[model samples]
Target: MTAGTGLIPVHKTDNINKLKSLFPALVHYGNSDMLPMHMPGHKRRADFMGGIGKYDITEIDGFDDLHHPGGILKEAMAAAADLYESDVTYFLVNGSTCGILAAIAAVTKPREKILIVRNCHKAVINAVTLRELDPVYVYPKKCGSLGVTGSVDPEEIRQALAKEKDIRAVVMTSPTYEGVASDIAAIAVLAHNRGIPLIVDAAHGAHFRFGADFPAAALDCGADLVVESLHKTLPSLTQTALLHVKSTLVDDGEVAHQLQIFQSSSPSYLLLASITQCLALMAQDGAKMMATYSENLCSLRQALDRLATVTLLRQETGFFDYDPGKIVFGVEGYGGRDIAALLQSDFHVETEMAAPRYLLAMTSVCDTKETLLRFQTALSRLCHGLPPRKAVSFPNMETVAAEKVMTPAAVRERTWAKRDFRESSHCVAAENLYLYPPGTPLVVAGERISPEIITAIQAYVEMGFMVHGVNDRQLFVVSENMSG
Candidate 1:
């Protein structure tokens, strides 16, 4: 597998010409105006600029509606569903967050019990609030050395479901924020045996379906519902995603209704069209492209593994399989935030996520060999003169307990309200409160804030990380008007 040969095959002149033809359709599709813009104020103005003005289109006659996609948009979604081998697929213009919300709402009824992994995205928490559903929280396996969340153990899920016999569904995140994948197949079987549906937040695993050597996708592992963020790892525009329904546990009508409840009425035709184009590209040549990408990732990892002061995380460290495209490296002596700043300021390289100990860099099929090599070169230079890092103490696992304050449905009725941080210490939270990069909430609404949570919040603030759901930059409290 040479650099520009097998995996990264050079596109023939004809292939390039075919790709060029797509531009005109995208441009012409933008000009099919039906009426004056009542939604997005842009109105196709030149001042809006770039792809925004050209693609920021609304629902019109010729353009099939989003909610009731019976025409071109539906056809596009069907094509994507076929590619993924799913029973049905819906185009999500509001990112995977909306898909997650819809999936939770579709699977569980109000006040029904659900088993959810604690490391799930805030969107899942929001679903719990909206449905007023009771959740039995399952903690992810902990990596003491890295202070990072690992995959959820199958046994834990089994125990939680057993304890809560009425659990309507189980939701988990495969290939977590740090790119750690779980035994999704085993968990799916467990859920199915208990007559419960399994919903997987595979937002970071969209590319898993493409590569043969990659970890199994949620849908392939028997999950009933899988939500993927196409833009995260694929060459699609941001906020373009797919929601796949695979089992009879969830009806198509219920899922569709939930989608309508959560999704925007006037969806972006540009985003919908991009989903089609991305799926087409993936169906045609995804395997070949991903093979090349995997080869590059292996090469890049090997190069980074040899660095003295930096430790590149791999599956062998009791942490299971990882997404090769996600390059997570720990700077031995320096803080991750400081290293990220240095890379951005001095080396002109920006990373995806930065924590106290490690930084993440996401690679895609679009990444060039030169680009990766450049990142490696910058890293080597940065590590040359770094000082010894202080040993930072992270909170113990026992301190972070799941406290159920209200059902999912009840939490939803309380609109997200903002208050002063100083006044919010004891208030019930209405929104997710956590750091942006990792997006983990320390205190969800309905749960009282413990000293440990306050400590975590203070640590984040001291590290220059922004803490959401706080009032006046001092303390964070939950919203006052919370549902029962």
Candidate 2:
């Protein structure tokens, strides 16, 4: 028997599909009579990798390489570009992390200034550190009682661009972890006026293009480079993402080169197949699915609105626009951790994330009406059962931009000491410290740790939030001798 011939066959569909290329090619190779001699030592065997081994291929003949896509992979990427209306799109098996890194590196040279939205994902910070780019900050506006950051004002971008004449590129995250989106069209215009290319880390907003109910995709909003995680809001395997290049300002060759640097050489064909399948499904039936999903979310919101203590956060004044899929619920007098724990322990429903004042539940087109109703019922039960207790006001973290003492690269060369987070006041941090779910650094490396930052960390810790980069409640700061 050929390698994995004994495995149960995947079901076949006769109907013609849209954006169909890579998946079919992989499957064809898997079921062929060819002998087993490939780099993937599994050799299409379903022994250890389960059924996935059958399609888990390497850069074999006809499969086409991810880095140098000239065959089926090229066609698949082209189809995705068409679907997304980008000039060119590349599949990212390494997820949005590599995409963000590649995009930032492609557009800016080392030590060049790149204006960054301060509340960006930690990957952006990593990109700045890796490329050694000098980052100028533009913090997002605060909205609502949840203390979640809102959109970056276009005016702020305009001001930063006008002030920082040496800035090479601009980077921002749209539809933050809490689902608030910036005015990308306006911001893109502001960046372009200064001849700077805008790179939007739209990892959480991948589904925006699939439905009218969602915010506009950053690519369509005129961003030069847009990186999206297909897995975040779509039905794709984890670590699958897409990087789109739409403007002449960004060099496609440079982007490809940087992606080769950041992404693994042996990209997983299984993940590629997952991306192909997801895109095909989206191209075919995504609009209908998104419509139904939007309707269900609305109904769920209406049900949630009836709760006396529980409040569902929606688009309010000062917020540009919010993604409907992010379900943020807040109950007075209760920490978000408590709500999330009750949902997990009592109702068996795990939420996406929890902050000081609010718990976030992420919904996608994959969620069914039954699932939404169950979540709604769980919230209703929890909200009714809990009594009103003393509430702690959430600090306005949006206003607390840490003092930048040095570049992240410079901080890496210094001696570090671990100090109790509370006692670490006024010390320059040697590492990033931020909440885990959002991963936005409250105090990035090379920044002075102020008392306000310490208080914020203590508050989050007291409310049971996971603080990353802290060991045993100790934060890494520049050693006392190096403090000068």
Candidate 3:
């Protein structure tokens, strides 16, 4: 294959066939309600003499624009909303990160108070900062045996809403990074009764509504706004996501304005086409595909359950419900990072997420029985080859009182700079420092650092885990010197 001015040559038809076979969702193209005379000048033309593929067209005439969609793009979004059973839906060219930012920006004002679960993604923290919103932290339940963060109690959200009467909205992560889900219905009811809207970060729950084993979607539970990352659990390309608006809590104009502000002007036509394709596929055979995926996931979990060294985390105890596709296993003797590394190096299987005690595997409709069997074989081998498990010392929850010191707005005003952990003990942090994979922050901006946080930071570094927003080899500490 050669690349030139928007033209390329295909040398082999087998390569194209193999690619299509790998992703059956993209193999066929059909004409339906979408008119090809608009922005995409290709008119569904397959023969692009240049290097570009057939779908690589730009906004031109009859094809409605993405930013201001009132034509074909709008119709596609409406169809997607109907499939998801939401009031309105918008295609997100950027990842869920952009949708998150836009949703937060749309509902709250500068420096306004909002309630957020502490175990949120880093994107939430960035949204809080960008919108200058204050966040009242709600600590999620902790799993002792797995050393993993679980879902937040609805009572905790109720308490925060009661205490902070001025809270404009509540932001939550359902089917969390660990695949743990909260009682979104209860939370939504509480927020609505208090005249506030609930915005759910459903980035990992794009297929929840289509699957039998998955928990009910955030929108189904009365959340005002929900963001879904289609690429995470669905058969869409990377950076393709959806932002949904349900009822009247938020104005449509405000939501549209915020989306326009956050979204890219030069959106990729390839990504948009992929979204359309994935949506159509889902509408056609999503339920059947998800049912098969669920069976595979359950079988894999059952097989893993038989292993003595590996303990699978169940959703009934700490979590209200769970997404079956997310396979989280707890190895008794090995750190999650070590187990993940071992799986990658020895078995050539890469896990989705890893923490101190838990390793996560995300199964999609694309996953095959062979893939699951391979993973099982590798995990059993690893269990037999590993040494005795060590007892990890986690900080006691009683000693760590949940503190609401600075609001999200206050945290945003502060500047962030990297400082030596050894030298900057008493200094305040201007950023949320966390270990990746799980993406839970031990320390937030403007809060006094506890010895517990310092110890966690050191432990994470020694374990060779990637810590975000910090660069020190030994330790990552926040500095008072913010001039730089």
Per TM-score, the best of the predicted structures is: 2
User: Candidate 1's residue-wise lDDT over 160-241, tens digit each?
Assistant: 8888889899999987877788888899999999998999999998888878656778898899999999999898889988
Per-residue lDDT of model 2, residues 1-484, tens digit only: 0011011112222222346846777788889887877677877776766767887788888788899988878878888887787888999999999999999999988999989999899999999999898889988877775667888889888888889889998999998888888889998888888888999999998888877778888898899999999999999999999999999898999999999999999999889989989988887778788879888988999899899787788887667888888999888788788889999999999999887788899999999999999999998998888877767677655557778989998888789888999898898899988778778888889989888888778877776677898877987888868644
What tens digits encode model 3's per-residue C-alpha lDDT throughout 1-484? 0011111112323312222111222223222334556444555555655525444555545546898888667777877777776778889998988999999889899989889888888888888888777788888877635655667899998888888889998999987877778888999999999988899999998888777667888888889999999999899999999999997898867888998888888777678877887877766677778777778877888889899988787665676777767788878867677889999999898999877767888888888888888988999998888888575654343224335456545655556555676555666666667777556566676666666666666776776776775675433333455442
Provide the clash count, candidate 1: 23
How are the candidates ranked when ordered by lDDT, highest leading?
2, 1, 3
lDDT of each: 0.76, 0.85, 0.74
**Model 1 weakest lDDT span, ten residues long:** 1-10
What's each prediction's TM-score?
A: 0.87, 0.93, 0.85
- C-alpha positional error of residue 366 in candidate 3 after TM-score superposition, expressed in Å: 1.4
Poorly placed runs, candidate 2 (over 4 Å): 1-18, 31-33, 49-51, 390-392, 395-399, 480-484
Tell me the number of clashing residue pairs for each predicted model.
23, 0, 15
